[model samples]
Target: MSLRWRITLAIALVSTLVALALSLTVHFAYAYRQAEQARQLQTQRLELALEEYDRTGQPGLRSQLNDPKLPDRLREAASEGGTAAMVTQTPQGAVVWAALSTTGGDTLSLRSSYQPQLDDRASLDRVLLMGAAALIATGTGAGVVIGARLSRRLRHAAAAAARVADGDYSTRVSAAVGGRSRDEAAELAQAVDAMSSALQNRLQAERQVTADIAHELRTPLTGLTTAAELLPEGRSTELVRGRIAVLRDLVEDVLEVARLDTATELPELSDIAVGDFVTRRVATYSSEPEVRVATETVVATDPRRLERVLANLVSNAYNHGRPPVVVEVDGPRVRVRDHGPGFPDEVLAEGPGRFRKGSGGGHGLGLTIAVGQARVLGARLSFTNADADGGAVAVLELPVSEGEDAPGR
Candidate 1:
């Protein structure tokens, strides 16, 4: 059951048990009081009966003893030489009877009918029962009200959490949900709000630094590349030019990654055949990699970003793993796998992050950029070691396209 129902039932049960205990206490106390009053009246009647027995002797006493006014229980007590008392319900309401033996051979008995004490006790029982019912009803109502309020507050917190998980750093638990209440739920809301704020600030700072670094490196890199090109043609000059080109590419990649981080690079989605797209992207690679088209399917995606993702995967495979680098498209998904000592355990387990690369790996932003681009397109990018070939595989599952035509159509 939900928290609301659990709390409601718990409160009702506890309140009912408490009410029952109190009602029982009152009921027993009233009964005891009525019994004491009956005993006292019986004692007085016994004294009066003994006096009458001494004065009138057996004849008048016998008539009094056999009086119809007395109850059966009292008559028995008086005739036998012992004490007895009983309360019985009659058409005229409840009556109390008591009897005792006198010093003489006769017995004394008393019948107190229309006794409010006994009758009041019965009335009190009805009141107690009614009061208990009222208390349980009141408690259950209160519990439901309190539980619903608490559940709403908890749901608000949960919604805020979901927004944050979806990369919406601007979302926060609102003050109206609690309105300055310093309860535990309020504390949780406060904590989530603080966490989202901190993440937004941190990401903003990281994005700024990345943009600044990339901007700062571009001018010097251009000058270096021009200076290298102007040098005399020789082995040394060739090495220098190649190194400058690598540095230029690195700076460009950094800027691209920064753009991806800030979500500034919006995908220009278009309808394209999955097989043709993968084939065209793989054809650009210098390695002339093999391609497998398992099924012809169309997809809606940003051609430029998708090509960039495929290019990076192909480059990483050739640079870091044994070739026969293959690109495979099955339906709306593509896989780039290389027959090399798969991905290092750490990278596969912890996922690809900026500056986290394996031995002999490029500047670690490649896979990170791929992941960001995949996320922007509402796709899933996953890395795993292939089971049969024991090679690293990067699988990108793209969003479904609007078109359903086959490839080359």
Candidate 2:
């Protein structure tokens, strides 16, 4: 069940228990008071009957002399020379009785039917029952309203948290209207906002450091590349040039990573056919992969960024996986699979992280860069191992164009 319904049910259960307890208390108290009043009236009638019998030697109306039906307890009290009264339940209904001993060694008794008071009690019970039901309904309704408001606030906070988790550090949750006063939902929103702000600041500082270091090295690295190129042609010089080229490439990758971290670059979107785009990009590779076009889907995306993402995937597969690599385009979805050892468990679980190289190892920035570019294009990139074939498969799903149906449609 949702939080809203759980809270509503909890409130309703408590209301029901309280209504039952209060109804029982009111019902019993009212019944007790009625019985007391009946007993008092019966006692007064018995006393008048005793007075009339002593003067005229005859019982009064509805009064009995030496009544055989009187209860033993009432008879014992009357024999002690004092008036006594009691209310008892009978087959017909409740009955109130009173008795008194006369000077002639006889007991005078009186009784009245308590059915009328019982009828009044039944009416009161009906009213109390209806009142209790109304109370429960009112309480349940209030719970629904309150639960809905709280659930909405929580949902907003959760959405903001989800955006932050998806790398949109700028996302923040708005606080409640009345600045946090014992409202846990408002406090939760404030906490999410604070966490987002902290992460954004930390990431910005790290990106700045990375950009600064890459920029500082680029000048000296360029000078070294020029000087090395001027050297005489030999095995040693070629080795020097090769190392310099590798270093330059590393520097450029670092800079690109820093730029992606900032999330400030916007995509240059254009309409492109999925099959043609994949085929052309795969052809540019020195070792081309087998390409299969399964759909003629068209999408709006940045060709440059899409190529970057695809290049990274293909390169990673080649470097870490075995041939024959296959790139399949199905609608807006592209899958690159290489028959080799699948991705490590950690990589599959956490996706790619910079500087975390795999067993076949380069600097491990290839997949990380791919993920960043995919994010920029508003696409989804996922990694998985093939079920039947033991190979790593990278799936990239691009966003469909506006006013266009998805692949199946």
The C-alpha lDDT values of all candidates are: 0.79, 0.88
For model 1, the local distance difference test gives 0.79
Could you tell me how far off, in angstroms, the CA of residue 302 lies in candidate 1 after the best superposition? 0.7
Instruction: Evaluate residue 119 in candidate 2 and report its C-alpha lDDT on the 0 to 100 scale.
Output: 94
| Candidate 1 weakest lDDT stretch, 10 residues | 58-67
**Highest lDDT against the true fold, candidate:** 2
The count of backbone overlaps in candidate 1 is 0
Clashing pairs in 1: none
Which candidate's TM-score is highest? Answer: 2
| lDDT score, candidate 2, position 229 | 83
Model 1, 1-409: lDDT tens digits are 9888898999999999999999999999878877777767756665666566768664232334545666766677567766666777778877666666656654555566646776687789999999999999999999999898888888878887887767777677765356677898888888888888888889889889988999999999989988998999999999999888878878988888888777656788888888988898777667888999988787778988888788878777887788788889888889899998888887789788787766665788888888888888888999999999788899998887455654344
| TM-score between candidate 1 and the true structure | 0.75
Candidate 2 lDDT over 122-213, as tens digits, reads 99999999999998999899899989988877787787788788787766676422345567777777777887898788888889999999
